[model samples]
Target: MDMRALRYFVEVVRQNGFRRASATLHVTQPAISRAIGQLEEEFELNFLVREPRGVCLTPEGDVLYRRASLILQQADSLASELRDLRSMVSGTLRVGLPPMTGSTFFGDVITEFRRQYPGVQLQIIEYGSNQFAGALSDGHVEIAAAMLPIEGEGFLTQTFARERLALLCSRDHRLAARKKVTLRELSDETFVAFTSDFKVNNLIDRLCNQEGFEPSVSGRSSHLDLLVSMVTSGMGVALLPVTVCRGIRSSRLRVVTVIDPVISFDQALVRHRDTYLSRSARAWIEIASEVLGFHVDPVFVA
Candidate 1:
């Protein structure tokens, strides 16, 4: 049996329809149908039942699905292992990172990774912490940086860094005079928050709840610069990473620590435990661990 045909069949089953599988695989629907049809003909059994909404698997199809999945996983592992046997590392490493805080944590790691591994192409996918799990599961990214503790099983993590959340407001604002403030003090202040999909928004929600009042949100944005701009314009105050707030060059904004119950989150490098880690991916983790986690020189490659 053709491995390509097996892949097509598995994708069709996973997607529940030929059209969706075709879209995912970037192949034509007729091509996927032909491949699955060939598989059924080879086995001399009907594997799927055609329906208006989608396709359903027969008992034989279910068995084939389970077995084929293992086979594909093993096949991929074998290929990765063979590649590792080479003396040099040269492959694409796809990594997912949050839009706002990712740069603060990974900018140096990214620079060092590229410098050390010029043969490997690095692909950085921007995803919020909330989306990292799905992105890693879907194979869109091989590894990711996320806020810990990442939910769910079948994943492994290495601690990246820990940081406290700080408050940003216009320099002229009433609370700007203080070097530190608590969530309760800002209970009545208008807030500029991140979009719902960002995990920082979740952090904000929890902090507000702990302080006994909900934030009166006046603006929401995905970009840190825009959020800062909103705060600078006196639209509302924003909560951001202390490091990020400190890096802002604007004299019009105040970066104050949040206390009385300091809001903080741990960051980590996460990946599917079952997925094969290419040399490039391993190198990335090494550099990140050295620079961001251990604060030492990386000796993994040389």
Candidate 2:
């Protein structure tokens, strides 16, 4: 059948009458009726049932309507995809970034990317490590940066950097006098922690569990900066990634390396293996690797 006839049939089905479809299509009612008649003749089946109140689709018409709707929708999407391909670097790139580690590379990479692709728009969504992976899996973001140890089927993970997890405390705290400490040494100390939702918090819990004790969490905050501030104020001690601790060189806070059973976390770039990366997304990933001085491999380690 002609595409035009199919379009007319769809309009008539939508409007529920030839008169309404003709008015909407700017054609005479006879023309709309004739188009529907021609479609039915070509298909060799009755497509619509006439009623005094309105028109109703026959069984075959219902099937054809469903297929026609899908075809039209795909046609529109194809047009959009063609336009995007013609100007590959001029669309929005939606990125999901975990806190702290994301900021480490954002400034340099974003600056360089903008300089390279002036037409591209970058949209960054900040999520905690625990939520970043989920955002990517659920298709809420096109790309994500998260802490390592993420495992699932059908995901592509790239390790970008390795950072130590350090013990942070107020300068006046007793542990500050020591050059280094072990996880067992902090058994009795009160700690400041991120919320239960954070991956870092889970790591801490796992370490504490391995030490045969639960952490004495005195305070909890979602923001890493605020957590550091609380540690500096002597509110409580906290274990923070070296990246974050290094970023904030507070005189009131002192950082010590954990010697025994040392723990490290990897920063990763993750995306779906099956999905195609847009030009902007791929460019941003490349910029990230260059700024960090490391080529990220698609792998995760516990």
> Could you say which candidate leads in lDDT?
1
Best by TM-score: 1
| Residue-level lDDT tens digits of model 2 in 1-302 | 57677777877776688888888779888887888898888879998998887799989999987777555544433443565779867777778886666777677888898899988778887777777654555444668888777767677888778878889999999999788899999999999988776787787889889998899988998788888878888889988887777888778888898977898888778886544566677788888889888765534211
> RMSD (Cα, Å) of candidate 1?
5.4
What value does the lDDT take at residue 28 in candidate 2?
Answer: 89
State every prediction's TM-score relative to the real structure: 0.75, 0.70
What's the distance in Å from true for residue 87, model 1?
Answer: 4.5
What would the per-residue lDDT of candidate 1 be over residues 1-302, giving only the tens digit for each residue? 88888888888876789889898889998888888889999999988897898899999998988777667756665676678887568767888988888888889999999899998889897877888886666455778988887777777777667878998999999988898897899999999988887887888898788889988999898888899899999999988888888789998999888998899988878887777777878888878877875532232222
Instruction: Score candidate 1 by lDDT.
Output: 0.82
Clash pairs of candidate 2? 157-298
| Cα distance off (Å), candidate 2, residue 148 | 1.3
For candidate 2, the per-residue lDDT at 132 reads 63
